[model samples]
Target chain A: MKILIFIFLFLIGPLTFGQEALNIIFQPKFETENLVINKTYLFKTDTLKINSFKCYITNLKYYKNDSLVHVSRKRAHLIDATDSSTYYISEHKFFRFDELRFNIGVDSLTNVSGVYEGDLDPSKGMYWTWQSGYINFKLDGTSSRCPGRKNKFYWHIGGYLPPFNTLRKVSLKLNKSHPRQIYIQLNKLFEEIDVSEVYNVMSPSDKAIRISNKLQLLFKQVP
Target chain B: MKKTKLLFTLSIFALLSFDIIKNTYFFNPPQYFPQPTYDFQKNPLDSNKIELGRLLFYDPLLSANNSVSCASCHSPFNAFAHTDHDLSHGIFDSIGNRNAPALFNLAWQKSFMWDGAVNHLDMQALAPITHPSEMGSTINDVIEKLNASEEYKTLFFIAFQDSIINTSKILKSLSQFQLTLVSASAKYDQVMLGKDVFSDQEKNGHQLFKKNCAICHTEPLFSNFKFETNALPVDPSLNDLGRYSITQNPEDKNKFKVPSLRNLSYTYPYMHDGRFATLKEAIDHYTSNIENSDRLSPALKLPIKLTSNEKVDLIAFLLTLNDKEFVFNKKHQFKKISIETKE
Candidate 1:
C-alpha cells in the first residue's frame, strides 16, 4: 500500500508541477472566412491569392493583473501560416496569462548581434542579402489590383534604424473566461492595403512603415 | 608546510594571471584617435579566431562557384581596395553597383557601406557573400562547405572550441580579423604625433584642408562618417539615390558616407561610384565641377576657389595620408597553407 501511494504521488507530481504546456495557436483568417494560401480570396473589390506569408514574432511576454509574469525563453520565432508547426508556441512555461505582448519584427540589438540559430537563422530566406536586417514581415502573393509585372505584389517590411524603425509592438488581452488561442485575422490587415500603389516594398521605406502599421491590427482574442 | 602552501598559491596566481592576459585582446589605437565604438567585450578577439577569419577571407570556397573571395576585390597590396576596376567585379564577371571601399580602421566606423546600409561590421560580410553578383552564396552554404573541409574543421575547433560551423562564429571571426586593420602609420599620423614634419607644399595644403575639407573629412580619422552630398551629379545610368534609398527621405537624397582620407594613393578611383580615377580629378571636381542642387552639401554650396598650384599642394598634402606600412603589412596577407599536406 505504501509503495502504491508513493508511485501515485510521483506520477501526479510531474504533471502538477510546471508540466502544463501553454499553447498559443495562430489561425490565419479573412474577416469571417478562413484563409487558405494559393486560393483566390475576394478582398474588397479585388481578387488576391497569397502564395506565402511569413513574419518574425519576437520578445513574447505574458502578464497577469497588468503585471508581467512570464516571458518566452526563445527570443524570436518565424511563423509561416501554411505550416501549422510554425504557428504554435509550446516551449514557454504554463501560465494563467491575462495578457500577451510581442513584437512583429526583430529588434535593433538582434539585427546587429551577428547571426543566431533556429528561426533567426539566415537560411530562413527572411534575411536581406543586399543589406543587413531581417525582413520583419513578409507578405508575397499575386493580386489582380496590382499593376506591376505579373500582377505580383511582394511586401518585405523591416528597418531597425531611427526615423524608419518598422518594428511594431502588439499587445492582446486574453479573455480568461474564454478559449486560450489567439486568432490573427489577415482580413483586417488587407482591409486598408492598396496593392496597386504600394506593391513592391522590399526594403525599409515609407511604404514598408505604412504596411507595418496595418499589420499591427491583425491580432485578437478568440473564443 | 606553510612555505610549500604559499609557493603553490603563488604559482596558481601566476597561471591564472597568464590566462587572463591571454584572453583579453587589446586594440592599440593611436593616442590622438577617439575610442572605438565597437564593444569588444561582447565578442572578445582571440588569435585562433583571427587566424580562422584570415583563412576564410582568403578562401574562395565561400563563393557559390568557389571562384571569388573577399581578397579578390579587397586586395591587401592595394590597401584592401579594388583599384583595377571602377566598379567592383564579382562572380561571373558581374559588375557591382558601387566601388569596393578600402578596409581599415573599421572599429571606429559607426556604419558599413557607402549608403550606410549595413549597421554592424559583423553583418557586413553577409551582404557580399549572399549578393547575386558578389560571392553568390548563402551563409548556410558557406557553413556546409567549411564543415566538409578537414582543415576548416580543425581551425574551427581551435578557434571556437566547438567544431560546429555556425553563422555567429563565422561573422564574429571575420570581424575579429577586420578590426585589426589599423592604418595609423601614415606621414600625416607621424606629423600628428610630432615624429615627423611635412614639407612646405604639404604644410600649405594641410592648412587649406583644415579650412575647407576638415569639416567633413575631420582630422585623425579623416572623416566624420556622416552622409553628405559632395555636389557630384547623379549618374543617370546607375540612378543610385545613395542614402535616400535606405531612408526614403528626400532630404537624404544623393547623400553618401564621408570616406576616410587614409591610403589615398593606393585607393584610387575616389567617390562612391569611383567616377574620379585620380586625386587631381577629384580636386578639380571639388574646385570647379560641383553641380548645384537642392540636396548638395551646404559647405560645398560656396565654390571652392583653389588655384592650380593650390590643387597640387592639396594633392601633395593628401599623399601624406598614405601608409605604405599598412598596405604592405605581411600580417594581413594570405597565409600560405598547404591544404594537401593538412589533408
Candidate 2:
C-alpha cells in the first residue's frame, strides 16, 4: 500500500504543483523550410551551409494583462538547431496567458554563479571558457558570399557587462485562436545582416550588442 | 498525526546530515578576514573532494597534449605562480599573453584573470584549459579523458559517491581545493592578531604602505581587486590594453585587476605583464617611472616620491606579507596517487 502511494504521488506531484511540460513546440526554420545540418541552401545566389546554430532561452514566464501568472525560475533551456529534441521548453501550468516572454541569454545572476549541469554546463559549447558568460546566441556557417577563408563566418554573442550586456528579453503576444507554436525564423536574421563585411563576432562588443538585437526578433508566435 | 510524525523524522535526519557535512571540512579564516564570497552551501567542502582537486591540479591530463599541467605554470612551490618564466608557457612550448598571477586567498576574490574577465573561481580554470596558448583543451575533452581514466574513476567515486565524471564535478572539485589556499598566516597577520610585533623598519614600512598603496591594495586581503590603472605604458610587443580588451570602455584602458600583495616574495616578476623582476624595480616604477595618462588613477597622476632609505624600509614590510607556512604546506603539494591503474 505504501509503495503504491509513493508511486502515485511521484506521478501526480508535478501536475498538482505546476511545472508540468506544456504541449507548445519551438520550431526552427529558414524562410519556408526546416533547418537541418548537412543541408545546403541558396542565400543571394550563393550556397550557404549552416554548420551549427544554438542559443540559450531562459526565464520563461507568462502573464495576463500585466498580472503575474507563471514563471519557470532558475532554469535555462538550451536550444540547438541541429538537435531537434532540444526544441521543447519544459513549461509550467498554463490556464491562459496574454503575454508570453522569455530571455534570449542566461541571466546575469546565473552567469556570475558557479558551475551548472545539463544545458547550462560549460561542456555544452554554449558557455564561453575564455571569458565568463554564456554564449546567448551561436551561429556558424560557410557561404560563397562570405569573403573569409573557406567562406566561413562564426558569431558567438555573450556578455554580462553593461553597454554590452547581450541578454535580451523577447516578448510575444498570444492570441487564443492561434496554435501553440513559436517559430524561430533564421531567414529574417540573414535578410538584415550582411554576410561578407560582418563575418566574425566572437566576443562581447558594440557589434555583439547589435547582433543580439537582431536575434531577439527571430522568435515569434506562429500558426 | 502521521504526517506530523513523518515531518519530525525528516527534520532530525536533515540536521544529522548537516552536522556530518560541517564536520567533514571547515574553512576557517582569521578573525579579522571578511567572509568568503564563495557559496559553500552549494559546493560544500569535503576532504575527499579537496584531495581529488589537489590531484587534478597536478595532473597533465587537463592539457590537450598531456605534456603541460596546471602546475606547469602554477607550481605549488612558487606560491602557485611560476617563477621560471615571466609569461606563462603551455603545450608545444606555446607562450601565453599575460603573466600567470599567483593563486591564494581566492575565496575572498571577487573575480579572476588580470583583466577581471572571469567572474567566478569555478569557471576560471576553463580559460586556461581551453586557451590556444594554455592547456589547449576543451572541458568536454578533459572530461572524456577523466571518464576513461581508471584512476580518476576511483578517485571521483571517493570524492563524490558517483564515479561518472562531468564538467560541474571537475570544476567544483578544483574550486574546493583552491578555496583551501587561504594566505592569512603571514607575519603581518600574526602582528595584527596580537601574536607578534613588527621590527622598527618593518613598522615604518607598513605605515608608508598604508599612506601610498593602501587605497588599492587594501589590508587583510591586501587588494581591493578592482580594475585600476597603474600608469605603466603598454608593452609595444604584446600591445596588451588590459581591461579595455574585456570591457571595450575607453576609461578602462590600460587597467588590470589590483592583485593581492600577500605572498609577494614568492610571486615576483610583478605587474600585469611581469615587467618588473624585483621588489626594488617595482617600487622604483611606482615612485618615479609612472607615466602620465588620462585614465591613470587620480592619486597616481603625480608619481609618489620616496628616499632610497625609505624604499628599503617599505621592502622589509612587504616581505612580511610572504606566508612561508602556506608555501611549504604539505597538503597543497602534489601527491603520488596510490590507486591501482589500468593504463
Candidate 3:
C-alpha cells in the first residue's frame, strides 16, 4: 500500500507543474446590453442600428511579475462582433500573467508588406483599394440623426504613415492572478461620435485620427 | 563501387533540378537597369500564377456590374494606358479625377498612382476595384465570384496546388503577371545593347536630351521616380494639389511623380492632368509656360531653351522609346475563353 501510494504521487506531481492553458474572453457590449448587429437601439437620444463592426487586434504581449515574458508569434487578428470564433484566445499556453498589452490596429511594418493571408486577407474588406494600408477599424450603421441618403454613417479608420497613423496601443492590469474576460463598451464610443456632421470618414485624414483616439477609451477590464 | 555510382547519379539529378528551378523563377532585368526594389523573395515568381493573373486582369466579373475590368482603363494597345479620354472613365460612365497612367516595369517602382497614394505594386489593384468611380466592387465580392466559377477553381488549384480562392493568391498572381512586363525591346534598348545604331539626327537629339532632361528623366528606364513640381499652374476648377494631398507637407505641394518617358507615342496625352495632347505642346510648356513657384523642381527652375530644330529632334529621339513587341505581346492580351468552354 505504501509503495503504491509513492508511485501515484510521483506520476501526478509533474502533471500539476506543467503549463496550463489560459483563456481570454472578449465580450463586446453596447452599454449594459449585448451588441446585436442590425438591431435598432437608442443611442444619444437617437435611434440607430449597427450593421457592421470589425477591427484588427495585434501584437499581444504577456507579462509575468513586472517583466515582459512572451509576445504572440502570430502578427495580427481580425475580430468581427458577428463571428463567435473570434471572441476567445485558445492557442497560447500560459499558467498565469500579470499584465496584457496589445494594439488596436496593424503596425506600420505589416501595412507595407504585400498580400497576407488569413486575418490580414484583402478579401476581409478591412483593406483600402485606393491606398496600400489596411483599415484598422470599420464601423458602419444607419442613424436617424444623419442627413445623408438612407441616413447612413460610415467610418473606416486606418493609416500607417506619419502624422495620420491611427494605430493605438492598449494596456490593461489584471486584478486577479488570472483574468478570464475583458469587456469593450460600445455605448461610450457612440456617445462621443456625432453622426450628423461627420457622417463619412473613408480616407486617411484628420477625422480618422480623431475617431481612433475616441475608440481607445472604450476598452476596460472586467472583474 | 556500387555505393559511389549511386551517389554520383543522385548528385547529377539534384544539379539538373536546381537549374530548372532557377530558369523558371528568374526576373531577368536588363543589364543596365538598377536592382528592383520589389522583394521577390516574399512572393516568388511562378508561371502558373502569372497565367492565372492574366485571366483575372481581363475578367469583367471583378466589377460590381460585370462590365468593367482592369483592361478597360488600361488597354494593352496603348502601352497599358487608356486613350481617347483625358480623364479615365469607370463603371456607370463615372469620370475619375486623374488620368490612368501606363503600367509597366512595376517591379522597379517604389510607389504607385499619380498621387503616390499606394506604396506597393501588389496593393495597386485594390484601389481601382474599390474606388466608387472605378470598378465599384469589394475584394470579398470578387473572391465570392471567383470561388463560384469552376474555371477559376481549377486554375487556382493548378497555380497554388489548392482549389481555395483566396485574396492572397489572387493578389500574388496579379503581381507575377505585371512584373513580367519588362519593356527592354525598344529601339533605345537596341542602341544601348550595341545591336542597332541611331541616325545622326537622333544622335544629336540624344545629346540635347542628356544635357537638358537627363537630371529628372534619368537614363535606361527614363524616370528617377521622384515626386517633383513641374511648374504646371494648379487648375482652379480641378483643385488638384498632387502629392500634397498624400504627404500634407507644405514643401511637397504641387509635386507629381516623374513619369517614365518610354512609350510616349502610345501613352498620351501627357502630364498628371492630361493637359498636353501632343509632344510638341509638352515641350512648349517646359520651355515657355513654366509657372514659377518655390516648390518647383530645381532642374526646371531655369527654363529649358530649345530651338525649333532641337524640339523636332527631341521628339524624334523620344519616338525611339516605342517598343512595338511589348505593345503587341499576345500573352498580355485578353484571353477570350468563354465561361462555358472553360468549365
Candidate 4:
C-alpha cells in the first residue's frame, strides 16, 4: 500500500509544481570611445568581454504610451537590430530608443518547429540551421582596433538545441522613474570570448558557453 | 530498494495504460483508407491542440500587420480553398503567383504546397507565413502574437499542457486541425460502400471518368496525388512554371500536384492557376487546347475526344464527389470571441 501511494505521488508530482513567473523590463543604451555610425571599432586585447554594460531606453511607459506601444497583450517590439540603416539615430522617429530583451540561446523545450517570421524571422538572421533553433538574441558588428586583422572583429553569439542550448533569462529592477534605461559594459563579454581561435561561434559549440556567460552579465539592476 | 522497484513498475504500467487508452480513444481513421503517410508516432493527436490550431488558422494575428489569415483564402465554406479568385491575394493587396489549394486529408499527403516545396506537414506553414506575397509573416512572429493572447494561452495550455506557446506547438496544432479534414462521406463513397447507388447518368459519367481521367484521378480518394502536367498552355501574363520553380529541374517544368477529384462540386475553377471557372470549361481545355509541351503527361499524347453529352455525364459523376458534411462542420469554423478593435 505504501508503494502504491509513493507511485501515485511521484506520477503526479512534477505536473503539480507551478512555475515562478516574473515581470521583467528591458532597457537599451549605446556608448562610444571614438564614435561614428558607419565606421567600426577595434580593441588591442586578444579577448574582449562586455561584462557590465547598459541597455539604454527612452519614451518608455507602463500600461501604455504614444510612441512606445506594446504589442497588445505582449510586451515586445522589433528593435530592428538588423542595421543602423533602417533603425539609426537620425531616422527622425526617435528610432534609436532601444529596448533590450533576449532569449539568447535556448529555452526548455523538447521539440523544434519550422520558420518563424517576426523578430524570430530569418530576415533577422537569428536562426540556426544545423540544429534548427533561434539564437533569441544577437550582438554582432565589426570591431576594427582588435588584433585579429588590420581593422576586423566579429561577435556572433547564439545557441539553443540540446547539449549546447545556452540561452539565459534575466531580471532587472528599477527605482521610480518616468523612463527606464541601463548600460552593459563590453569588458567581460569581450574577455570571455575565445581569442585562441579568433573565438567565433557559428553553431552550438564550446563557443556557446563562452558567449552565454558573457551575455548574462549584461543584465543588472538600475539604481 | 524494494519500494523504489515497486513504484517504478507501477508508473510504467500507468504510462502504458495511458498510451493505449489515448491512442484508442482519440484517433479513428476511416475504414477504407490505407495507413496514413504521416508518422503519428512523432506528434500525437490532442483534442485541445486541434482546437488551438482552429483558432490560430482563423486569427488575423498570424499576418505581418494582422490583416490576413489562413481562412482569408482557404475558407471553410469553400472547402478550404478560396473562391472567385484565380490567384491568392495576400498582405497589402499583393497577388501571389499561385492559387491557394484546398487543405484537407493532410495526413495522407507525402508533400505539401502545389510545388511540394515542403516534405512534411510539420514544415508546411513556413512557406505561406514567409512567402512575402502570402501571409507575409514569420512563424516566430505568429508565436509571439499567440504568446501575447490570454485566450490563446488558455488554449495552448489545454492543448499542450502548458501555455508557453512555441513554433513546435503551433505547427503541431495546425497539423492536427488540418489532418482532421477527412472528406470520406461523399455520395461516391456511399456508392462504393453499397449504401447508395449512383443514378444512371452518374454511372455513365463514372465509366467515362475511368476511361479518360481515372489514370490520374484514380479511385476511392479520387486522386493519385502525383505531379503531372496535363498539357496546359502557359499563361503569358503570370509566366508561372508550377513545380519547376521548386525543383529547378527542367523535366518538372509544367507539372503540378494532381488534385483530388473529391469535393469537385465545391472546389471549382480547377487547376493550379484557377483558369477554368467551371467543370465544363476544365474538361473542354483538357480535350481541346492541351498544349504539347516536353513535360506533358504521356497519357495526353492524343487529345481526349469528349462529346458534349459525355462532358455532361463526366460533370454529373464529379458532382457526386461533394462532401457537404465536411464543409459545414462547425468544428472547423471561426471562434466566437468578439474581435477586439485595435486601439
Give me the candidate number with maximum TM-score: 2
The residue-level lDDT of candidate 4 at A61 comes to 31
DockQ of each: 0.49, 0.84, 0.69, 0.06
Native-to-model Cα distance after best TM-score fit, residue B321 in candidate 4, in Å: 0.5
Candidate 1: stretches off by over 4 Å: A1-19, A29-49, A112-114, A143-148, A177-179, A194-198, B1-26, B338-343
Question: Which should have the higher DockQ, number 2 or number 4?
Answer: 2
Report the number of the highest-DockQ candidate.
2
Model 4, span A72-175: residue lDDT tens: 23222233322322221211122222243333343434114333434344434455332344454455444433455532444555445334556665433344
Candidate 1 lDDT over B126-222, as tens digits, reads: 9999998899989889989988987787667656667888887888889988988999999998998999999999999999999889889998999
- The segments of candidate 4 whose C-alpha lies over 4 angstroms from its true place after superposition are A1-223, B1-27, B337-343
lDDT of 3 by residue, B66-118 (tens): 99989998899998888756888899999988888998888999999988888
lDDT per residue (tens digit) for residues A1-223 in model 3 = 9999999988887667765766677777887777788999887678988898888889988777867877777688887988967877664466567787889999999888888998998878898777688999888899999887899999899999988999999888888843767777877767887888878999788899988998778777775
Candidate 2 vs candidate 4: the lDDT winner is 2
Q: What is the lDDT of residue A136 in candidate 2?
A: 91
lDDT of 4 by residue, B1-343 (tens): 6776576446545544554334324456567877788777777776666666787788888889989988998998888998788899899999987778887777788777777666567667766777788878876688788778866775665556676877767877888778777887889888878899999999999999999988888787777778999877779988877777655567888888889888876777688999889888889888998877777887777779888998999899999999898888888888764322232
Worst 10 residues of 1 chain A by lDDT: A175-184
Error of 3 at A180 (Å): 3.0
Could you give candidate 3's fraction of true interface contacts? 0.93
- lDDT score for candidate 2 against the true structure: 0.85
Candidate 3 Cα outliers beyond 4 Å, as residue runs: A1-20, A43-48, A142-151, A191-198, B1-26, B336-343
